[model samples]
Target chain A: MVIQDLKVLICDDSMFARKKMNMTISALGINEVFEAADGEEAVAKYKENKPDVVFMDIIMPRITGIEALKQIIEFDPDAKVVMASSVGTQGHLKEALRAGAADFLQKPISDEDTRAILENAAKGVL
Target chain B: MFAQFFGGYLLHKKLVTSEDLTQAFEDKKHTRMRLGVLAINAGLMTADQVEHVNITQQSVDKRFGDLAVELGYVTEEQVDKLLSQQPTEYLLLGQTLVNNGVLSNAQFEQAINDYKTDNELTDSDLEGSKNESLNKLVTEFYHLEEASNARMLTDYVTMMFKNIIRFIDGDFTPLEAIVIREFDAETLIEQRITGTYDAVTCITAEKDVYFEFAKRFAGENFGDITGFENETVGEFLNVVNGLFAVNQSNEGGAELTMTPQQFIQDKKISFEKPAFCIPVVFSFGEVDFIVSTE
Candidate 1:
C-alpha cells in the first residue's frame, strides 16, 4: 500500500492533541485519517474504519488506551496500535507491550515521529 | 530556562522593572551578544571599562577587542575566548537590556553576578542546563523549601518552566509564588495526578490572558478553532503534568498517572493542601499555575 493510501486513527482525549496530529498526518499526504476522543470511541472507530494504524493515548475520560488496545487486538489480532501517551513509564511500557501494542510514543509526539510511523505502517513494518 | 529564571530574579530584586524585561525579551531576539557584554559577564572587565572602550572607539577606528586589550581591560587570549564562546540566552537578554538602555553594563554585571552567587550557579551550570542547577534555582526562586513536598514541588515547577520554554514562549517572567487555599478563577483548567500520591494541578487566568496562553500553545493550527480556548489551555496543563509524571516514574520509581483535564469558568476552587500559585507574566499577560501535593 502507498503511504497516502494508509488509513490512520488517532485516539486522544485532548482536542488540541487530536487536531495537531490530524494536521500532521494530513500533511504527510495520508488522505484517510480518523480521530476518536476516547478509548471506547477508539475501539468503535477501529472496528468501523479498520484503519491501518492507531495512535492511542493512555489517559482519557472513559476506557483507558491499554484496555482499548486489548479490545482492538482481541477483535483483530493483526491490528497495529501504537501507545502514544504522556505516561511512558516502565510499568506502562510493559503493560502496553503485553497488551499487544505495536509501538509506544511518548507525547508531545513530533511531526517527524508521526510521519515515520505512517511510512513504516505503509511498508508493513510497524 | 536559566534566562527566564534570571529575568524573574532581576524582577524580584528590583534591578529591572517588568516593562524593562518585556522590552528586553522582545529585543533580545535581534540583539547580538557583543564583546563588552561578554567581558562584563565574565568579570574580566567592569562596565566602566566597557564604557571607556566605547569612548575610546569614538576617537579611534580600532575594534572594541583591540582597544580593550590596549586599555588592559582584558587580555588578548581572554578576548579570543569570549568571542569564541556561544552566547547563552541569559547573556543575550542582559546584552539586549544594556543595548536598550534599560540597564547600564554595570547593573547587568552586578545582577548577573548576584544571581549566580545567590543561586550558587556556575557559568557551566547556566550553559549546560544541569538539572541539579535548575532544581536549585527553582527551589530558591519559589522558596519551595518551606513547602511540605519541597523536592516534588521543585521538580514539578522546574519541569513546568522547561515545558513552557519548549512548547510556549520563553518570553515570559515567572513571578514569585504565593501559597493559597482558595482562588476565584476567571478561567481554570485542573488535572489530578493520582497514584502512590494525590496532587492537583491547575492553570488559571483572566479571560484575555487565558485566551493568549491558549493561543501560544495552539499556534497557527487552530486559528478558526472556535471555543477551543479551554481545550488548548487544558492540553498545556495536561502535557506538563504528564511529563512530570513520566519523570517521577523514571527517576524516583514512583508510579504516577494523570486524570483527564477539565475546564472551569468563573468558579471558586479550594485545595485540600495549600497550593502554590505561580504567576508567570507573558508578554500578552499573566497566567497563574497552581499545584498542590498531598
Candidate 2:
C-alpha cells in the first residue's frame, strides 16, 4: 500500500498526544485515522477497524498498551502494533516484544520518527 | 539546567532581584557574550585584566580580543577557543545582566567564582548536561540529601529539571523546596508511581499561570479550551514520571509504573509522608511540583 492509502489507529490516554499524532498521520495523506483514549477503546477499535498500523501507548487506564497489544494479536496474529511509550525501559521493551509488538518508539517521539514508521508500514516492512 | 540553577543561586544570594532576573531572561536572547566575560569565566584573565583591556580599547582602535592578546593576558589561540565556543545559557544570562547594569563586571566575576566553588562545579560541568554534575547541583540546591530517599529524590528532581528544560520553558528559576504534608491547591494534577516503590507527584498552579504553562506544551490552539489545561499539564507530569521510571529501571533495576493522572481543583490533599514542594518561577508565574516517596 502507498502511504496515502494506509489507515492508522492511535491509542493514547493523553488528548495532547493523540491530537499531535493524529495531525501527523493525517498530514502524511492518510485519510483514515482512528484514535482511542484508553486501552479498552484501543482493543475495541482494533477489532472493529483493523487498521494498517496501530500506535499504542503503554500506560493507559482500563488496560495497558501491552495487554491491548496481546488482545489484538490474539484476534489477528499478524497485527502491526507499534508500542509508543515514554517508558522504553529494558523490561517494557522485552515485555512488549514478547507480547508481539511490531516495534517500539520512545517519547517524546519526533515528527520524523512518526513519518519513518508510516513509510515502513506502507512498504510492508514494519 | 545549570543556567536555571545558577539563576536560582544568584537570587538566593540576593545578588540580583527577581525583577532583574526576569528582565535578563527576556533580554538574554539578543545578548552577545563579550570576550572579557568569556575570558574571565575561563580563568585566563582576571576582572582587573578585563578592565584594563576595556580601558585600552577605548584609547586604541584595536578589538578587545586583539588588545588582550597584545597585553599578554590571553594567547591568540585561547582567544579563538573562547570566541569559537557557543555561549552557554548561564553565561548569556550573566552577560545580559552586566549589559543592563544590574551587575557590575566585578560582581559578575565574584558571583561566578563563588558559585562554582560553592557547588564544587568545574567550568566543564557548567557548560554541559552531565548527569553527575546535575545530580550534585539538585541535591545541594534543594538539600535533597536530608531526605530519607536522597538518591531517589536526587534522581527524580534532576530528571524533572531536565524535562522542564526539554518540554517546558527553560527560562524558569527553581526556588527552594519546602517539606509539606498537606497543601491546599488551586488546581493540581496528581500521579502516583507504584511497583518496587510507591511515590506521589503533583503539579499545581493558579488558573492563568496553569493555562500559560499548558500553552507552552500544548501550543496555542488548545489553550482556551475548557478543562484542557489540566490535561496538558497532567500529560507533562506523566511524561516526566515515565522517563524517571524508565531511568530507574535501566540504571537500578527498579520496575515502576504510574497510575492515570488525577486532577483535583480547590481541594485539600495530604500526603502520608512528607513531600518536597519545589516552587519554580517562570515568566508567567509560580508553579509548584510536589514529590513524596511513600
Best by TM-score: 1
Best by lDDT: 2
> For candidate 2, lDDT tens digit of each residue in A25-114?
888889999999999999999988989999999989899999999999999999999999988878889999999999999888889999
List ranges where model 2 is wrong by over 4 Å.
B70-72
For model 1, how does the per-residue alpha-carbon lDDT over B64-167 read when each residue is reduced to its tens digit? 99999998878899999999999999999999888888788888888999999998899899998888989999998988998889999999999999999988
What clash pairs does model 2 have? Answer: none
Question: Which regions of candidate 1 are displaced past 4 Å?
Answer: none
lDDT of 1: 0.91
Please give the lDDT score at residue B219 for candidate 2: 61
What are the chain B TM-scores of all models?
0.97, 0.97
Q: Candidate 2 at residue B161, lDDT? A: 92
- Give the 10-residue window scoring lowest on summed lDDT in candidate 2 chain B: B218-227
Residue A108 lDDT (model 2): 85
Pairs of colliding residues, candidate 1: none
